[model samples]
Target chain A: MTTSNLHAEIARAIQAAPLLSPIANQLLQVTARADHEMKEVIDLVKCDSLLTARLLRVVNSSAMGLVHQISSVDHAVSYLGERLVVGIAIAECTNEFLGKPLDGYEGESGQLWRHELFTAIASRAVARHARAPLPADLAFTAGLLHDIGKAILSEFLRGTSRELVADIVRGDTADYLTGEQERVGLDHAEVGFELARHWKLPEALAQVIRHHHHPETAEAELRPLIYAVHLGDILAMMGGQGTGSDSMKYHLRQEYAEHFTMSKDDLALLLLECSEEFRKVEASLASLKET
Target chain B: MSQMVLGIGDLGASNHPDAEIKTYALGSCIAVVLLDPQTRTVGMVHIALPESKINLVKAKEKPGYFADTGLPLLLQEMARHGCQPKGKGLIIKLAGGAAIMDHNDTFNIGKRNLLAIKKILWSYGLGPRSEDVGGTFSRTVSVSVRTGEVILSSPGRPNWKI
Candidate 1:
């Protein structure tokens, strides 16, 4: 689609996608305190049984590589500390809120999860070098749930026309995004931004989802956060885990680093740090398997 | 299938059964299961996130992300061809789940994926003889049970043996 058409469609999708309804009460009360404290957040998380169990399972899982047994939420929180602890809690919370698969991509089932994790990693790395106010955990949650709109409209789009989606899979953006815009009148980014606003996530994060691919227009206040998260996604896509069935069409823009005011050295450091961090996190995760 | 590069949502196994089943660029997404000793059964699913205990409907929609829903289904599918979950030892080797999100911190998916698999294994109490998982660079993984090799290749050259 033309740039103007693309912009309009994305704007429309933002209108239709699933997000917290202002009328609805908070989905769940959360008391996640910053400054890396754990007990307070644990108390809030413990109130939710499913979250509690999942958190415990996550704590005990061999994937983490931590042999320590964390019996209580408080203990689990303390053991992992705030950054990692909050990240895990956010992962648990995210699964509940994020809807089904998106219509455009062939996620099959778990594609969103994969995308989220990678996004989180990418954001943390980008923000570290950029030194933006955005917290790694906040970006992680934002990145994890960015493409949520895709799931909400997957069935509708599937029924709308399989051929259009086939074209998107084939990287015919003009047709795919345009078709999506015509049908839903908005793209996934707009929809996701709305969801973020409704969720009361950091405004910057919401904007990141809204303008991640094209942060030039994001609100000035939210620009840096959006840029960091955007670059994170781009990096993950570059890493090539899964940019959906239509990845070939979207190439990474080198200007993102400059937009975020990151130096080449900074970008190199981000990648270098990410690589080292990937190993550490991977090792920690490996140990967390269910025993 | 094509040996070139099987991007996400695309599964490709080497046409030759004797040949290896290789897929690169795996991070948090699963490399699925690749079994060769018996019949040519290699499943690779690129699950983006983790399970949604709170959202069962979403879970139903995304069995690949959640260990609770995805593993049993995958195992059952493999079982259709006499590869029962409990009976035979399928030398399963897993990789990916490198938390690119947090460098100072680590997300639970890499851990969760591992845990989910372990729980499935616990039901049957099965574990891979060994594995090479969790790194920053996207992994170039190859699993050939027939040859008993699960090689992982990162972006830079000099991939390691499993």
Candidate 2:
């Protein structure tokens, strides 16, 4: 197939992809703001009875281990915070898309969700070291949705892992993104950007989905958050939570040093912290998977 | 037969003859498999990083997360199960530590993890009997306690005994 035809197919796939839940969409909009209030998140959950229930359940779930049972939506959202609330809403609405098997990458069902969850948690941790003010929760949301394109592109990429790996080994392609472009004419990042646009996601998130692998290319103001998600993605893969064969196959832009003030020791600690949080979050959100 | 699976930054040992110990999706992480033929005991540690000094508190809570802390704790676990780390009957096998494609990457964790594990093992006068490490692919590894055979499998690759 020609490059234009492949891109056309990708556009169609993006159009057919599932849309985010109303609650999730609003949550993204609210959280994307630099000065969004916690009350806004609380009010959004209050509007959705099911989200309220899930939020309460997750906050009181054994994974959280609170001594007292809390039944109030406001209390629940406050305790779990906006990131976990957003994660719960997104996971609940997109389980099929997020948890599906990635045959293209030889990945099992739910692998991508786990990898994204880790990246979300890791991105939040990475945000702490940002040289400038960056909302940690926005970073979490970007990390969570960073690889959504992989779901749509996985089918198109079927049976290409070997050729891609071989190409990478022989230096015929620079990295997995290049290998992907060489084989399919569009990489997952670009595909994800299309999905983000289809979902009418926040501009910052669309930028991240498009340029996570090469954060330096993103607008200068967004680099810090983009770099957070970038390192968070790498940290997730390094922690062995990658989706599949393409694990750690991308180039790590050392320019992240300019965006964040992380040292080698800090990076190592971030991995440990992220893994620890990922365990608890995965357990807490297991109930969402069932729904 | 029972199967024990280790997640990243985890370790375990078993003495049951029919037991199998395994870990999945080992990208840059290293899995150290220890088997004792005399006692038919097997152990494995999925190490994610090379050192413990990065976070002493985490190392104390989950020593299996790093090569320095995890290897020692894994050996001690083996000793408790009657599998001596330095015993002649012990067979040590290493797998995983696959690097990313970038040669200039500062976080060359896979190579650093391999070097760290080897250095730690040398301190105990022990080394792997065999190793299947380094690549751009993730690996899933398993060891049989009864036969002391370690097998490795990865996506798009055939399963092989290491």
Candidate 3:
């Protein structure tokens, strides 16, 4: 396929792809609100049976180590509190979409999901450490969805472009993003950005998906959000949680420290903290496993 | 065949002919493979940092997390497995230690890790026979006890024996 045709085809696929279910989207929006009450969140969750089931299963999972079983969404919310419950809900809601492997990226079954979960977990910690101005929920959302395009574009790769991607994944080349752009006419970041737009996600979130690999190109106001997810992706990879094929080709912006007003010492500490956070997230993800 | 995976802060050595040891996603970390060509025993360590001076407690607990501590411990295990000394049928191969594109040179842990491994190995009068180190790529290193051969793989590259 020609460059434009391939881009167009990928765009069509993103539109048809599984999206954040409406209830999940509402739950995320509600969780993002500072004024949201525990009762309000509980009521919102109770309306969706699937979400409620997922929440209870996770809260009661061995990872939580709760002595008591969570019988309902209300019990889960009260026991685990708001943010933890919301994080679980997000994972449950997007489980289907993010769960599949991106063969083009060399991810085996569930590899992409695990990789995104780590990124989401690390993104929140990174945002907190960097003191980003946006709501931490937004950081988590961006991080989780950052690589959604890989799934969409997996089917579109072909010919020499496919070879370049293979080479990039193998570490034969130092630039996967650039190599994709040069050979395939677009990269996953750009595809993810368009995907987010198609879903009508927040403008900032779309920009983040686009500029994550190149935070320097994002608008000044969105840099922190972009940087948080950017650094989170880097931290996840360096922590050895990379998905497949494209684990270590991207760059880590040095100016991120200056931009976020953090020192090198602070960055290192954040990584240590993120690694700890990653383990917790990994354990919690057990809830997503087949029962 | 028995295959063992070495995590980020792990080390293992094997003398069994059917054993194959491996480690993956070695970013900014170093993977050292030591082998006894004659005995066909193999030792591998995945070292995540250059030194243990900063986190002595962690280093003490997981000696495989740093080149300074892990390299020596890995060599000791090789000896326990009946590996010959320095140039007498002993082979060392190195892989991993890749800095990202935008990371400042000062914080290049990959470079630091390679240097630390070199320093420690030099202290013991040993150096790598072949290396696939540096660059902005994560690699997986594997060694087979039967053949005493080391293979290195990166994201999109073919597995090349070192």
Best by lDDT: 2
Runs with alpha carbons beyond 4 Å of true place in candidate 1: A1-39, A81-103, A131-133, A159-179, A197-202, A251-255, A258-291, B1-17, B24-162
What is the full ranking by DockQ, best candidate first? 2, 3, 1
What local lDDT score does residue B98 receive in model 1, on the 0 to 100 scale? 54
Q: How many clashes show up per model?
A: 41, 0, 6
Q: What are the runs in model 2 whose C-alpha is more than 4 Å off?
A: B103-106
What is candidate 3's lDDT per residue for A1-291, written digit by digit as tens?
A: 688887777778888887777776776667655566778888988898877777777777787777877796778878766656666665665676677766666666777776777787778777876654656667877788788777777666533434775566576755777776776688889888888877767677788889999898999988988888998788777666777666767878776775565554454455555665666657766766767
Clash-forming residue pairs, model 3: A169-B155, A169-B156, A170-B154, A170-B155, A170-B156, A170-B157
By DockQ, the best candidate is 2
Task: Note the DockQ of each predicted structure.
Answer: 0.05, 0.57, 0.44
Query: How well docked is model 1, in DockQ terms?
Result: 0.05
Displacement of the residue B88 alpha carbon in candidate 1, Å: 40
lDDT of 1 by residue, A19-81 (tens): 543211121223212353445566556666655665666667665656777788787766655
Residue B9 shift from truth in candidate 2, angstroms: 3.0
What is candidate 2's TM-score against the reference? 0.94
lDDT per residue (tens digit) for residues B36-126 in model 2: 8777788999998899888788789889989999998988898898776554567889999876555334456778889999999989888
Task: Name the weakest run of 10 consecutive residues (lDDT summed) in model 2 chain B.
Answer: B99-108
Ranking by lDDT: 2, 3, 1
